[model samples]
Target: MASSNWISGIVVCTLIASCLFVVAGIIGIVLGPHILQSQVEKQLPLTADSDQLDSWSTPPVPIYLQFWLWECVNVGEVLRGAKPYVVQRGPFTYLEHRTKTGVYFNDNYTVTYRQPISYTFVPEKSALPETTRITMVNTPIVTIVALLRNQSAKTQEIFNIVKNFFNETLFIDHTAREWIWGYEDPLLKAAKSLPIIKDLVPDDHFGYFYGSNATDDGLYTVFTGEDHINQLNNINKWNGISSLPYWRTPWGNQINGTDGSWFPPLIGKDLQSIRLYLYSTDICRSLYAKFEKHSSVLDIPTELFSIPAEIFLNSTLNPDNIAFGTTDSGVLDVSVCRQGAPIYISLPHLLYAADRYQSRLEGIEPDAPIHRTIFEVEPHTGLVLSAQKRLQINVFLQPEHFIDDFKYISEVVLPAIWINESTTIDQKSADDLNNQVLRFFTIVRWVSIVLIPIGIVIFIVTIVLFKKHRSREESTPLLFAEANNTIASDHDH
Candidate 1:
């Protein structure tokens, strides 16, 4: 009887424990995502105060600009002066300042931030000559001369007088060897001389050639197109491709896009391609005004993908062609990039230029891939982990109707220089991301595999105990009745 009672108590305890565990497992399965999402929401940039917005939304990405200037080694010596050739020069490094501002939220949960123009600072002044100083002093003089020389025949006398006045008095610094990049050729020199009776040579200053005027205020806005919780598609509407931001998710927030980073928030495991649009800078706008296309996909290890710099270099996000700033028909508009200068944009090392353009150059590593723009991204979170932004500067050299020697030279798009700005996540941030993902996976594994199995075992044990207690009770009642009958028979005798 005591044994039966003990078994009955054990059955009841086991059953209760099993029920509790099952209930806990069900709750975890149903409510786990909600709880995790709530926690993540609290840490989101949308909820951050003004002071914390910069820290939370903006990543501390370091950008390095590597300049590969084209040096004219032998001015048409090998090409027989018919075609001037240039060689690649130093990979000079410049530190670039990058940050985000003007953060605001929309009613639909999308957030937009202004990606200011990056300020380029050379840590070592000796590394590269101050292009800014030279540009400021020379551009105004060049502009005045070009405008004066474009007058009608009736104004030729006035133009000549102004040209001579400017030429005799306005002598700019020639310290930075302009001919090395084909900026100060015979045509340019003749244009500088008043006797030639032509427009002034187009300004070769960086600002004049690259449309740096728009970048003066350095304000460019970028939208994340994500909800307050770092999830994608919260807004039911899809804007045109131009409205798309620099990142997106293939998966929604709950099952995907929940990665605690700025990009790729809801990437799926099976997706092969993704596209992001970045607001083109003025320089880029000269070629193609719309947002630049940044396409990537899952083609590498998650570990490497998590490293932004590595993936950016190795992935398809790198340019495969030179049509970045050109029209679909491959026509390059020189006037759009810079007013009078026939400047063109390209990737570093002349990677995407036509064969005719690249063939004239020497010292090019045949094996070295052209444009080395790269982006390391975390697939799960769709976050950019690291990146190397690269672009090349080129000038279109054509024979001027008035210039004598330029008529013999082949018209070509000459590479001036290229730059690469690279950035990566810091060690502390990387470690934190790893830890957070690991903890999430660990908890999921424990609840589904370990905790649920333990609950099932307790339920089975409860059932066995309950059956045993019932069997003992049934047998005990029969045995008691048989004993009483035996006692009654003895009394009758």
Candidate 2:
């Protein structure tokens, strides 16, 4: 009985408190507009491009899809006034999966007799051409290359970088040098043998080398289209091709777009440096205290897919902390140090200048990340870090067979790649922060609104009960007084 009575008392008090809260909340609701207005009126810049870095382009190019497994750091889709960039063609668009070969060359033939052709092309194949062409309309894709060169000095360090370029992982080497692997006939003896074709190579060199087929006696020329002349002409404009001799393969005549001659670009020179913008990729393993599979923010992976110098050293950071600060001054710059060992650094602003040169050659518009980050780097550095490091941007272009270059185009080919790319935006730390703040305020406002009405009802009930009890008590007193007065009058008579 005592417990029940205590519970009843608690319930009554809670109801009364709730009623008061509801009333207060009703008043707060009326002031909500003012609060909302204040927040809305606060100004925020959409795109920070006051101090913009100009970009470069190369022209007459055969379009090869670049697949960037980017872990976006900021709200690219929102700021660009559209949905985030995705691989529309989906996953595996750039993976060439081939099952059959019309013919293959045999090395068993004697000097007087030419090599016999076999029915199969050797090496493990990825995505086949017909398969990729079928799904070409579904995903967003970009062409990517494995950068393999030293842009700093013309020393054996270049060979070390080249040998390790596509080793077990990908890393950005800033020493300036020409480099390439998987050339058709005249294979490089070492990374040192790469030709110095271009005169204006950047101190911090950047380029990419990629091939679809792999083999011993030089891989077959896997050309995909008949526009070889146009593709060849376009590559020449970028000044990124090889000066090595070309050898004709019997299979070259059999290739669908057979020109019977192949000239691949110097590994670093055949690529557009502007295309080396930093993108977030899934880390094979976490190295930092904050890094985890579930964590949102991710640093560039030097051990995964190859990232060029233009993208690596493209931002500025606070001196005390190497965190990216502002790109307004120039391309964001960074000193890549592991346990205090400085590896390589780049100035995206300088790359942006190089981008301008390349853009003039290519007709395609530069992507959003390219224009925004590179442009912001200049202003941020110009005002604060005047004595900052500056790196040059070099362009590398390779004349990949139409089908060969297209393998990396995740946009038109891979659905899985597209899904992964799409999911990258929601996983960013900034998005997580914004979402958490929004949820907290939303819950608070809703709970306060709900309590206001209950508080008002309790307050009303308490006032009514008190007034009724007081009125009844006063009536009894009045009745007693009247009766006493009547008795007194009778006695006097």
Listed in order, each prediction's TM-score against the native is: 0.59, 0.28
Q: What tens digits encode model 1's per-residue C-alpha lDDT throughout 1-493?
A: 6876776687788888887887787777777655664554444334325333564455565556565566555453422344444565555555555455665565555554544444454547335663422210233333334344466644544544553544522223333324122243332344456544444445423332243211332322233333433343222222222222212222111122222124434333233343332223324321111112334433322322211121112113334223233322212333343545455655555554456666655655422333544455554454566665666666555433222233344555656566666666666766666676536744854685565668889899778867776787789889999999999999999
Tens digits of per-residue lDDT, candidate 2, 1-493, equal: 5764675576678666866697667655666534543332221111112111111011111112222121112223222322223222211222212222222222321001111111122123213221222211101001112222224334334434443453411112111111111122111232224564112211222122212223211222221112221122111101111221111232211112111111211122222222211111111000111111111122211111122232333234223112332322222222121111111122221233334332322222333233222111111011100011112212222222222232232211111111111111112433443353334445556766877766777667766765675587669889999999999999999
- Residue 263 displacement in candidate 2 (angstroms): 45
Q: Please give the distance, in angstroms, between residue 18's alpha carbon in candidate 1 and its true position after superposition.
A: 5.3
Among these predicted structures, which one has the highest TM-score? Answer: 1
Q: Candidate 2's C-alpha lDDT? A: 0.26
Q: Can you tell me which runs of candidate 1 are displaced by over 4 Å?
A: 1-52, 56-59, 78-84, 99-218, 221-264, 268-270, 282-335, 352-354, 366-370, 379-382, 432-438, 445-449, 456-493
What are the lDDT scores of the predictions, listed in order?
A: 0.45, 0.26
Q: Score residue 197 of candidate 2 by CA lDDT.
A: 16
